[model samples]
Target: MVEGETIDTASLDGYVPFDSERQQAYIDAGYWRNITFHDVVDRHAEEIPDYTALVGPHRELTYAELAANSRRIAAYFVGELGLRPNERVVLQLPNCTEFLEAFVACSRVGVIPVMVLPRHRSAEANHVVDLTDARAYVVDYGRYSSGFDFVGLADDVRSSHESLEHLIAVTDGETSSVDGCDAFAEMRDERWVDKYGDEVSKTDVDPSKPGVMLLSGGTTGLPKAIPRTHNEYVFQWERMADAADVRDDWVAFPGVPIGHNASLNCIVGAALWAGATVAVEPELKPDALMAFIERVGGNYTLPMPTQILDILEHPDLDQYDLSSLEVLVSGGQKVPPRVVEEAVDRWNVGFCNIFGMAEGPLICTRPGDDVKVQANTVGRPIAPEADEIRIVETDRETEVPPGEAGELAVRGPGYFTGYFRNEKENTENFSDDGWFFTEDVLARRDDGNLEVYGRIKDTIIRGGENIYAPGIEDELVEHSKIANAALIGMPDDRLGERPAAFVELTDDATELPLKDVSSFLEERGIAVFKRPEYLEILESLPRTEVGKIEKQALKDRIVDAESK
Candidate 1:
């Protein structure tokens, strides 16, 4: 059951954060009747037609105008391109206005969209596109990074995929172009805005049809394509938005890659679901983000943990007047205690924790949570606690005791139905009782709050004993000399496996070798048995496209290095 069942029938413009009871009261009403992900923007298009819904570095589209552009793109899709309902389209691009335009257009047309990270190698996108049998694709063909020719890669994908019929190139304010691709400019030239605007109506939408496909991190093995019905994610956004104080008057800054589930589902999607505005472009540069925040009197920012650390450590941190910020959320990684400490004690803002994932419900700190509580635990369960949120022991999916680590499984209105076209995956992920297995391991803290304990698939089994990486990681962060650490199990002949520590240090800190780091941990309460055997410190850790430390990548590297 999709959880977002009419939380409020009141005007969205006046909508503000509501407590659990009021939230349920609103839910008891029909605020969400006949609504889906597409419905959010459609309602906004009618309610606040003239308001700015999207702002990019190059273009700004009002709600009505966005709808107009989306209609045109949708028409191009349905009429010219002949994209069918529930058919898949691949959108791979950096944070750009055109990506949003095309994505929204797909939603309006009832086409399922699969967002591939723009940083994907041509080979990766090729594999995904082939697997999905994508009907069309959106790319930033002329983009250049690391001096690689994006156009060349795009061309290769178009040639390689048999079902890939259309390639729409979204440009970045430059005239230079890629040949053999349909440019975004062509749509305007073809009067696509006038031709497609409102051309397709929502006559056939079921609200239960699959709308988006999110690929898992493939941490344990191959990436699985998780398909979500429109209503499932819509319910997630509506409830989470109401809980997180998302509203029309609020301005949110999401610096993470929009392609990630955390950013799209919880942060930006929730914001838009409530008629709130996100910053024009996702501000990556701290200075630019600060400027945008100052410009809009922005109240909310939910940066990745490392990003927040960078912001806190910036030499010019004192120069920015961020008085506009009312709340800060840290997730996708653990927030350094010192960073969390300063964010609240010094900044005097609501520093909160957001624990979330693609296949599960989200938990975020409410407005009234104290700084200490917010810093200590990720959060309590989100309400309309109609959903089943439980931490189960290893062998079976039954509830666990406090302070005991177990895998998390949730059954709720916001949970996904199944993975796309993968019955085998569905069989493994869902239980006979109807709960979706999130596969994320977590622990209930002493205070009855939950702290995510890392992926169950990433767990280390050494000599028949299981080790959770996050436990060691949190302890590693507590070390005064350490900046950030990731523990990955390396193969050991006798023990079967052992742990390794990969540390990324502060800019100016002297290099601490493995021996010294081990000594520091031993001097603390960490037992010798738990200490990492091999510690490697390099310049920086490699991150996924969305800024998450790609442990798989790191593990692969470690394996390669050891073998060499």
Candidate 2:
């Protein structure tokens, strides 16, 4: 049976319905303007036709050009492809100008865009297709260097997924020879828009329904789908722009995949909302990124911790001119205090810590914050007056005392109410009153900042003692010889589990012994049991697609070594 058959048309299965009282309150307070992304793009195009809206390595588009291209694509989708309003389309493209155009076009025609990472293969792609009952799959042709044939992948998806009808390819190199596939460039034909522009323009758009679907970043199990309405999503970006101090004249660079929430909403969405320019780089190479920033006079960017560390340690760092960079924001994991200090001192740049999830409530350090606050903690909620953040016990209902460590639960205008189609998980994660439990363990500092201890699941239980991985990892990273550090719990015969250190050294020739590690932690006042018992040196740590260190992968490696 189809997924949406048993679900209400107005409130789809994968989409969580908004609370009526909160919705009305938000609308009345002017937090939600009832405006869609289509409205934002159209208004910008009319008011600032000549403003440069999107820039990539090879091409740049003005607001007027973006609007026209979106309209044409919308017309082709509706008129030629016979796509109905609210149909789901999977968008799996890299960071480029075409990604922006295709996404806006979906919004323009009332089609729901389901975001999928470009690195995702058949396993992930098929799951999304089956979950959403998607009608189309959009991808880029031969653009990635991963050596996988995207055309072949698309064909494979079409063959397995019976609901998917159209395979759209954005050609960068050679056009696909696939018989039924459509070229994305051809969809820009003016003739199609001229013939069916009126009908496509009249497509019914309901602000109450899901406009976009974002994938969760959980480390365990399949990623959950989180849907957000147009009004709420737009309000989120608008507020993010304000909090980040994104200006109209600033050029924003997004180094991560455009499909990720931090990249799409906090970086790209914020830039467009402020009438600024967005510079897109498909790859995250530090050398290429440095050149792009120098060439475009890029003023702002949001990068992961690994990217920042690479840029700081680049061999030819002095060769480029990156003086235009004013604000640098890092998220997706805890930003090492040493990395933050180095970036600010060497580059004379302002570093901000951004902590957020795909579900909602972004906490960021602002320009006016004290330097220590910026370095030590992820600052308070962006909209503290409107958003509610609580430190609660594991039961997720009882509130903990201030400055105590517990699970982080949040409720806000920008946060989603529940997971799409997963009522069982929702009942477990969310409270009866409306708080969405984030599973992350954080404590409120006396200065009103948040000190994130790792995830509740990430805690290493040795015998009966609970040891937070981030707490140990943070101390280990501060060591002069360690470049990066990750702590994972390995099965122990005596204790239930023991902490193991996976470290990437600053000098490859250097060797760090377990005794030395223990001495260093002792000097730093860390408890004896909390210190890691085993030390493994590696060239590098395994990271997720979004650049987070995958602890589960490290645990598996240790397990494999023991089995041998």
Q: Residue 67 error for model 2, in Å?
A: 1.0
Candidate 2 TM-score, true structure as reference:
0.96
What tens digits encode model 1's per-residue C-alpha lDDT throughout 1-564? 022222221311211112345335435654334466656887889999988777666667777777777777777787678776667798876666676677777887677788787667766778777778888887775442324556577678879878888877765547544566677755543465455444456336545556677777644345666666666677777777776777687877667667778778776787788787766454466776666667767777677777777777788888888887877877876655567777877677876687777765677766568767687677776654555687887665568998888888876556765665567777887776657677788888887678777787678888888888877887887776677889989889999889899988776677788888788778787767678998888688887645578788778988899889
Q: State the C-alpha lDDT per candidate.
A: 0.71, 0.84
Best by TM-score: 2
Q: How far does residue 244 in candidate 2 sit from its true spot (Å)?
A: 0.9
Could you tell me every candidate's TM-score relative to the true structure?
Answer: 0.88, 0.96
- What would the per-residue lDDT of candidate 2 be over residues 180-221, giving only the tens digit for each residue? 678888888899889888866676566655678988885556
Candidate 1 Cα misplacement greater than 4 A, ranges? 1-32, 142-148, 172-178, 188-199, 218-222, 282-288, 513-515
Q: Kindly report which residue pairs in candidate 2 clash with one another.
A: 14-420
